[model samples]
Target: MWKFTLRRILIMIPQIILLSILIFILAKMMPGDALTGMIDPNVSPERLEELREKLGWNDPWHIQYADWVGGLVQGDFGQSFRFKMPVTELIGERIVNSFWLSVATLIFTYLIAIPLGILSGRYNDSLLDQTITGYTYLGFATPLFIFALVMLWVFGFMLGWFPTSGSVSPGSEPGTFAYVMSKINHLILPAIAMALIATVNTVQYLRSEIIDTKQKDFILTARAKGASESRVYNRHILRNSLLPIAAFFGYEITFLIGGTIFVETIYNYPGMGLLFFESITLRDYSVVTAVVLLFGVAAILGALLSDIILSLVDPRIRIK
Candidate 1:
């Protein structure tokens, strides 16, 4: 397992470099530079040239890429053109809120999806199963932005049960239980909005996996051995059924992290997603690259974790 993890980490280095190159290309394709808006209409050509030189925009693409990579190796993500701050610092300022929000969404999504999925599978074709299936289908069909807007309107505007925007209320006291609770309160709508589609996908996948597992020869053999229905379900069916779900758990983290863009933007939450939106609008290449790299790393890590978990849960996987 340790060797596998190390190997995966080693593999990630090249993947990230390739992803960085792609991001650099996209950044170069943008119509203008960081100084495009900043330059005065009457500014002398020499002054503009000096500014470009100072910003290293005059460097060859390969040289710029090399410098960027060197800075990345030294733990510097470069400076954001729009924000005028180091990309690392800008991301650091926002990542914690996004991380916590994603965590909360993951917890809520699984807590709701798994048990309902189990019951739906256990009573396949029943009214309960049909109802859950319909609900999940609705979730899948709904657009995330539309759902976010509706949730904000219904819960925030109409009922006023939750705050409409931001990670927490202004002037929230730090290091207090009240502050924590306030943050959670502000998180409810966006988290739910983000998790809605994910929950449906999880439920649908688990239900399908469980149904197939219960029909397998192993399950039939367990039943023929005079195992009680509950025992067979708990000891055999459920355990086997969860292996795929467990593997998917890691990918779900990646999904939720990416999905946070809509939720955080709609809610005006101060997180990576919101920052991503703002950075893109302002053409902040450094920050945009940093954000993309962060998401890419997360996805690679998630996939690696999923493989490791699958191997652990099913010995056949490890042996193979």
Candidate 2:
């Protein structure tokens, strides 16, 4: 396991480097630039040239990339022109909010998906299975923004059951119960919006897995040995059936980040997703590069973690 892990890490080094290079190139190739923010209609050409030179925008792409990589190695992701702060500091604050949103969405997704999927799979061809299938189809078909809007209109505007936007109510004191409650209330709509999409995916995967696993020779053997159906399922089939779902768990981490952007934007929650959107609009290259690189790294890490979990769940993976 250790050898496999080490090898995976080694393999990721080149991949990460190539990904970073691509991110940098894309950022540079964008039509506008952060220097636009420094320009005024009255600003002279010479002043713009000076600003460009100061930012090393005058340098070749390779030189700029080398400098960027050097700073990245030293834990400096560069300064964000959009916020006039260090990119790391900006990311730090937003990533935490995004992480919590993702966590809540993940918990909600599994909590709803797994048991429902199990029921649907166990009672296949029954009313419960048909109902679950219909629900999953609806969930899959619903556009995230439309769902978010409906959530906002019903819960936020009409019923007033939940706050529509932001992580907390204004003037709510931090570290207090009211603040925490405010955060959760504000979180519900967006998290649900993100979770709904993922729930469909998990339910479909688990339902299929359960159906396939239950038909295996081993499951039949256990049944023939007089093991109760539930016992056979819980003790034998469940774990084996979960291997693919475990792999999806890793991909879901990155999926949540991408989803968070849309969800957070709709809810006006301050997180990395909203930040990415704002940075792109402002042509904040530093923030854009940093966010893209972070996303790339996250995706790679999630895949690697999934492989490790797959190995643990199925020892055959370790052999391969």
Best-performing candidate as measured by TM-score: 2
lDDT of each: 0.86, 0.87
lDDT of candidate 1 over 1-320, digit per residue (tens): 66766776788789878988988878878887766766568887788789889888889988988888899889999888778788898999899999899988888888889998999999999999999999998998888889999999999999999998888888989999989999999887888888777889889888998899999999999999999999999998888887778888889878776688888999999999999899888878788878987888888888888888887776566532
Q: Over the stretch 1-320, how does candidate 2's per-residue lDDT look in tens digits?
A: 88888888898999999999999998889897887756467888788889889989989999999999999999999998779999999999998888889889998988888898888877888999999999999988988878888888898899988888889999999999999998888888888778878888888888999899899999999999999978998898787777678778898987786788788888889998899999999988899899989988999999889888877776687744
Q: Candidate 1: lDDT over CA atoms?
A: 0.86
TM-score of each: 0.93, 0.95
Q: Against the hidden true structure, what lDDT does model 2 obtain?
A: 0.87
Per-candidate total of colliding backbone pairs:
0, 0
Where model 2 places Cα greater than 4 Å from the true spot, the runs are: 37-39
Give the worst 10-residue stretch by lDDT in candidate 2: 311-320
**TM-score for predicted model 2 compared with the true structure:** 0.95
